[model samples]
Target: MAITNNRMICRTVFAATLLTAPFQIFTSAIGQVYPSLTLLFALMLFLFYDVSKVLKTSLTMKTWAALVLVQIISLLWAVDIREGIREIVYSFSFFLVFGASMQESKRNLRSLTLLIIAYSVLTLSQSTLVIYFRLIPDVKIQYLQGHLAEIFTSPNTLIDLFGSERNNVLDEAKSGGFEVNANTGAAWVGMVGMVTMGLAIGLRRKLLFFVSLFHLVAVFFSGSKAASLLVCCLLALMYLTVYISKKFTPSRFAILISFVVLLTVAGSIVVAAGSATDFGQASSDTLDTRKLIWAHAAVEFLKHPILGQGFGGWSETFQAYAWRQKISDGYPPHDTLIRLWSQSGLIAALVGAAFMIAFSVEVLTLVRSGSRTAAWIGAGIWCGFLFVSIQGLGENWGLLGTLRMSPFIAACFALSRALGYYTSPATRSSVLNTSVRQIKYV
Candidate 1:
């Protein structure tokens, strides 16, 4: 009974962590504190329940630990010690979450799937709400904002707790629901869409298929070029996978090809239409800014190619570099590899590369483990990871050192490891079969 109770507690905390993860973009203090607390609680529960398992050392863990160690050591020369310490703490949290997710995945795959589905549904609902309000006319937006403010607080205190600025609050009223930033929100929704698509195809559930479509459509409202492009790419990839797996009759193949052509044409139309709008111009401006930042980041990386700037030192380094070049102090490094190379140096970048390679290999192993269910789910998780990684190309949040979306990435890594373990030859007996049966029933 004690063991069962512990499992229940662990599962509840795990669910809470994933469900609240979408709200991590909330700029308020509570938005940050609650998710962090849940993560910390989950880690503690795993430690208390199974210390040995939690502490079990694996190659991936070793690489992750070494990477963390490098980040810590880099702090010795970091421009801002406080920022470096904060980043290190976030890195440690990600490590803990990664281990906990692996343990949770092994304990109950069925529960994990249900939790992920629930998370997807929640994110979908949030995205739907945001898109719905965004479609409303600009004239009534003020009225809607005022009404929402009245419902939440006094008229004088109009700003929502989720945002610090009135303009941000108004933006939230217009198009942001639970997530403060459109791009981040779209990325979260895109990740959920990938997982939902996998579950829909794997489980052959019609409702989940519609949910996935909704996710795809809703992401466009966020106006995140990366999310939009990657989700479409993933969709095409999914279609290709289906086409390759089944031997279709001539007519069926023709139908599939026709569908693909239509999708391609429709996407082209959307792109053409969007490019003529102010949103397109804004996206172009953002891309130009990213290019500028990347160029500056390359110069900074070249300056200290060996050790680079210390951890959390990129901002200061960029600021100084910007001053020297007589350019406006722009954003920090927009690319993850660039961030790592410029901040932690070449050695840390090598460690990061090794960790990513190991991580990808584990995920791929699950995808090709000869289990249809595991393969579909693994593929979805991989797509989700890929989406975030692509997002990292134009954003600073990598697979580590931040709370924004790192937990989700860590969860993906953990689930991949767990699924790989379960489908391995040594564990492919009663346990794996039983888990599959449970998933089927679910």
Candidate 2:
């Protein structure tokens, strides 16, 4: 009875965590505080359930731990120790979330799927709201921000709405929803949408297919060129996965061909429309600015090639470099790996690379494994992972360390690993044997 109660509590907490994940887009005090608290609570419950199970170390986990340790050690040399500590805390939160997810997944794969679907639906609803506001001529961006702030605030009051007064809002004309950056919002929506579509195909769900299509439309309303391109690539990968997984019947072949042609036409239309608008010019300028920031970040990385500048050291280094070069200030590195390499050094980079390689290999192995259901699901997640990785090249928030999308990315890693374990032949055989023994005793 005690064990049953504990399991119930654990499931409730994890479900809450997954459902609230979409709200992580809010850059408010609540947004920051709530996720951390919930994730920590969930992690605690998971650990309480089975400390050994949660702590079971693998090569990937070890690499991740080493990476975190190096970052912590680098704080001794970090220009701003306080800032470095904060960044480390944020980064380590992801590790905790990942562990909790692994434990939860072991107990109930179906529940996890339901929770994920709920998360995607909530995220899509938010996107729809943002798109609605964007289309309203009377609603200003600040007005939308204030409304969202109120919705997220405690006691339903708008008093002291956190991050409401933005010092630097990116692309005011774009539909960023509650996020500070439009591109970041678009990327987040796109990722969730991709996962939804993947599941739709894998599970043959019509509702999820429509939800994903809505998310795709929301991405367009966001006016992010990079996100648009990334979504296209993600869709293409999904199609490719379908092609590889299924037998090519005549009817199926025609359907696939139609999908390809339709996607091409739709993409062409979007491209042509964007080029005709000022958004195209703005996107071009943004890319140019990113290139400049990347060049500066590269130089900074070279300055401390071995140890690199410690976490939070990049701002000061870049400031000095920009001053010397008479460049504008307050720009981020924008790229994930570049930011990690610049801030944490080569050790972190190497560890990150190793983890990615190991993760990819594991996912690939699952995709080729005996379980047909697991294979398709794994392929879907693989595409989502690739989407995040490719999108990370142009943005800083899609990787493991960043606060914005790190939890989502961590969830991706956890889900992939969970699928791999639950679908393995060994696990299947064990379950079969256990069932047989139980039947004989009965």
Candidate 3:
């Protein structure tokens, strides 16, 4: 498929918007903003962008069914009218804009790759700026959030409302670096780490490798075990997926498989090698606390198996359930399935999971069956998203009132749409007016 002039321009603007605006709006004045400003850019692109190309296929039978089911169930369970609509629109918009991006432009890919680099470098610049102004110490310059204890615990968790003796207890074990919010800072670094890895694979640039190395260094400070594990898991998954898919129709699969395997394995090993020093060891107590929370959340799922007590009520429900069990950290289950079941019920979980599964399969098909640009973007967004989804299972990023929809999450959904996964390849061909038939994202 030919890279059209229009696609290039649109993607350039989109990538730039993501890289720049978030920093200015959220990170400009204060330490670090809650609910990262990238969310704003994602909404801007989804809501205002000229993306009718995706809309035509968006009303497909599958999407429509999922939307209707969620909406109906939401009406019954989604107590907050505005929040429910936002969630549904968020889910829908992710599909619509990305679905239209199927005709990938090399220019756009180049633009995206560059934008990622810019985002990564901002770490150095941000740190320098912080030190220069004495906003933070040279060594203590926060990577993502401001406070050190906030890195390990939520500063504004509102635990006081629960009447617990230890309300919003910040982890005092600042044995090493800055005390930024672990979820926000570390998760962001881990995500950027994955992005760099993906770009290194698709672009094969010397710069991407160094960029990846640097991002992992930042990840070291995040002290988020789940986020670190998540990056490795996604990279491993990507190489495996690429290898298994390449074995088929594309005879070039062997060479590509070998290449990806070598890169992924070697990269992981290198990252792990220094991890002994780079990554601080977590106490057994911390590990135990996480397990305890997860375990308690699991039990709540079984008790209220269906018809969760509506959106935004997870806390009220979680608190009520936890109080019975007497393990009162006041944490809503960090796991996605548990929180999802407790809030939206099985049906909502089913629809969301279906979209994810379908998106992954479609992405694989599109990449394996089509041009390089589309394949890279398709694979990049899909793998990046899957990495987060795996983490989301153990974290509460998408649990309604927590962090809202992630920009990275929205990007993955949008990229999937652009790969034209929702509509058949034939439909995309007709739009681009090209004979380049999409086989599937291999």
Q: Could you say which candidate leads in TM-score?
A: 2
Query: In candidate 3, which residue ranges exceed 4 Å CA deviation?
Result: 1-17, 20-47, 50-180, 248-303, 321-329, 370-380, 399-405, 409-442
- The clash numbers for all candidates, in the given order, read 0, 0, 20
Q: Give the whole-model CA lDDT for all candidates, comma-separated.
A: 0.64, 0.62, 0.48
Q: Worst ten-residue run, lDDT, model 1?
A: 25-34
TM-score of each: 0.77, 0.79, 0.63
Task: State the TM-score for model 3.
Answer: 0.63
- Candidate 3's residue-wise lDDT over 309-358, tens digit each? 56665666556656775666357567666655656677766665665565
Collision count of model 2: 0
Ranking by lDDT: 1, 2, 3
After superposition on all CA atoms, what RMSD does each candidate show versus the true structure?
6.8, 6.8, 8.4
Q: Which ten residues in a row have the lowest lDDT in candidate 3?
A: 167-176
Off by over 4 Å in 1: 1-5, 24-36, 42-46, 49-58, 136-177, 241-283, 320-330, 400-404, 425-431
What lDDT does candidate 2 reach at residue 246? 38
Q: Per-residue CA lDDT of candidate 1, range 1-442, in tens? A: 0144566666676666666665432223442222344445534544433423433545666777887888888877887776676666677766666766766676776776676677677667667755875676363355445554343222323443323333222452335434444555677677778878877787777888788889878888765666777788777755554444334244653564465457645754565568767666655666677777888777776778888887667766667766775655645677777777766778888887787666655676666666776667666776776666657767766654345456666776676677677777788885575665566555
Candidate with best lDDT:
1
Candidate 2 Cα deviation (angstroms), residue 349: 1.8
Alpha-carbon deviation at 215 in model 1, angstroms: 2.1
- Report the lDDT tens digits of candidate 2 across residue range 214-332: 98788888777767776876688566655554343446535544664576457545666676578666765676778788888777766788888776777776777667756566666
Please estimate how well model 1 matches the true structure, expressed as its whole-model Cα lDDT: 0.64
